[model samples]
Target: MSGISSASGILAARSALLAAAKAALDGQTDIDFYSGWQYPVTQPNWVATTDVHADMDPANIGPRRSQDETITLGVSIGAWLPGHTEDDIVAAFERAFSILNTIQTHIRTEDITLADTVLWCVPGATDSDGAVDEDGSGYQVEIATTFVCQHRVRAA
Candidate 1:
């Protein structure tokens, strides 16, 4: 049981995921990994992990001895370029998608179970959307996906 509640298990899963991401992105100086929120993003290329939602229900109808849970965690990829030209936008797009691909491949092969903290983990389809600043600050591209982690929580 490992004294793992649904909430605690979710936390453990996120931590493990962050660690795995760090390991996967290490030595790639161009990519920066953040565990949570980042304000006024400074890097041209960066990835962030955030909490999305969670679902939990009793594993059995009787006595609430255990529960099955799913926790959704988000990964956000951002690419920015100072120039606002069409070529700059294309470059940003390529960089953002390349980062997304690296992340997807790492998630697929590296830590599907989040270091045994969960039964299994899988990233959902990515949602891509972004905006360009009217003031010409930079060209920005963002891609986001969620990793759903399933686990069983036992009574403490």
Candidate 2:
């Protein structure tokens, strides 16, 4: 039997998923989507795609060394409003929701498989934290969603 390790499969799946998400988000034209560890909060508004976690199932289903892997990708939206008011904060939340909606739509309509790298994908729960001061300066609004992608890793 010969095949790639589960680790390799997970890494490939993660990268492909991130690239697909970034491409979809970048088409928005109003928001910037970035990958990797460098998260720039200095920007007034932006979107971030990060690989949160990866896991592999213990059981092998195929004839060779095979396991199912799940990659959790996080997409976060941030807006930094300096010297903002209540109305401003509310507006930020509205905008954030709109962006989230677009992301959801893209996932549902677009080819999430990334050319078979991912077998399947589903949007996970969403969380929001905002309307609070950022470092004692201005208000900040943040929203995040997770995508759980599954793929099969096999070597034969």
- How close is every model to the real structure, measured as TM-score? 0.82, 0.76
In terms of TM-score, how similar is model 2 to the real structure? 0.76
Worst ten-residue run, lDDT, model 1?
Answer: 1-10
| Candidate 1 structure quality by residue, lDDT tens digits, 53-102 | 77876544236567777788888888888787888888888888887776
Top TM-score model: 1
In model 2, residue pairs whose N, Cα or C atoms come closer than 3 Å (at least 3 residues apart or on different chains), thus clashing, are: 3-155
Candidate 2, residues 78-146, lDDT tens digits: the string is 766665777877877877877777666666678556546677667887899886674666677788778
C-alpha RMSD for every candidate:
2.8, 3.8
* lDDT of each candidate versus the true structure: 0.76, 0.68
> What RMSD value applies to candidate 1?
2.8
RMSD of 2: 3.8
Best by lDDT: 1
